[model samples]
Target: MKKLLIILLVLTGTTAIKAQTRTADESAIEKTWARFGNSWRNQNFSDMKDYMTPDCHWINVVGMHWRNLKEVQFAHQAFITAFLKDAKAVDKSSNLRFLTNDVAIMYRVTHIGAFYPPDGIDHGTNKQGDKDNIATIVFVRQNGKWLIASGHNSDVVAQAAASDPVLHMNK
Candidate 1:
């Protein structure tokens, strides 16, 4: 009878240890999402794929969509070229949660440095373009690493501010 009691206690202890370990792994996955946000803002695509699955899907409010890692990387490169042309990059990430051991979600906010057009072009040339926005990343754990399986972005457009500058410039 005593032996049976000892065995039960050992089982309970082992289960608790596993639960704690799983929690830690989940937290690490969330941190990976945060790191991805930082890398994207800095235009470090080289390491970006490490956080995403090869088959990840991405989309933005402009209707731009990417289905594979290659496309996703290229899309990001385009964004970096169009904007942040000599500007500092900054980002904030948070709101990470796991729906299951293999699935998670997080949000990020990025700020692009001051933008200026070519020497002859006006600074307000692209004022009508999109600005600061929010991105939601969904991750899935496969094998041993957490990968971003899907992403969605909702761009922030300061319609009032944008229209005013453009209209005033034409005046």
Candidate 2:
């Protein structure tokens, strides 16, 4: 009985140590996501690529297609032309969950710098929009670096507002 108790105590201690290690890894993912968002707002796509896998996949809600890194960067040029005119991503929040020591998923909400018209018209040359979206990103850490494996963003404001009629009416 004493031997069994000793074995159980060792196992519990090991488990506690492992859990602490995993929490540290999960916390790093938050900083990784922050770097990604900042680089994007700065139009530093090249710098941003370090956060993404070479074959990273982007699922854009725009219904264009599932784009690879290069295509996404090219598309961003257009995005920059429209949104980056005087806009930025602000009020960001990142929530991360670890699938493993090397794999993580993040849910984030952030404001885009300007309001985009549905017809692809650029408005508010210097002014901004109240538009923001929520996104999900999958990150994989390989060879001591974290790379984005997949990501998707969806419009959340209108849907969230619609759910609360009083808030919508106030707006």
Candidate 3:
């Protein structure tokens, strides 16, 4: 019985060490996201590049896909120029877990306060409200640092009932 107890204690100690190590990884990834959000709100998008991989991919809430860093930059720049007059972003992450020693997946709900234009540009958007959305990002650890590899975003949609014609339309 004493031998069994010793073995169990050793196993528990090993598990504790792993959990503590992964918590550090989680903190690092979370800090990366914090930097990204700060850059976004400040309209200092150039700073965000450092947190993303060279080949990072992003899917915006509007279903537009950015396949590369340059594409993502262009998209964000356009949005910042045209729509984002003044805004701030707050994100809460949950279910953040490491998929492997070098990868993590987390669900984030981002609440953005976006000031809208009087008339939206070519995309035909006029109505604007507080934009809140859920997003998932995969962070990959490379060279002992975390960087965003890919992200998918889905807006928290609000509309009328299905029976209403307005339901199918963007408000």
Cα RMSDs, all models: 8.9, 5.3, 6.0
lDDT of 3 by residue, 132-163 (tens): 77888989998888999999888766552346
Ranking by TM-score: 3, 2, 1
TM-score of each: 0.66, 0.75, 0.79
Whole-structure CA lDDT of model 1: 0.71
Model 2: per-residue lDDT, tens digit, 145-168?
Answer: 777888888766665676876865
Q: Over 4 Å off in model 2, which ranges?
A: 116-129, 159-171
Candidate 3 regions with alpha-carbon error over 4 angstroms:
1-6, 117-125, 158-171
The RMSD (Cα, Å) of candidate 2 is: 5.3
lDDT of each: 0.71, 0.73, 0.79
Clashing pairs in 3: none
Q: Which pairs clash (backbone N, Cα, C closer than 3 Å) in model 1? A: none
- Cα misplacement distance, residue 57 of candidate 1 (Å): 1.0
Backbone clashes per model, in order?
0, 2, 0
Residue 4 CA displacement from its true place in model 2, Å: 3.5
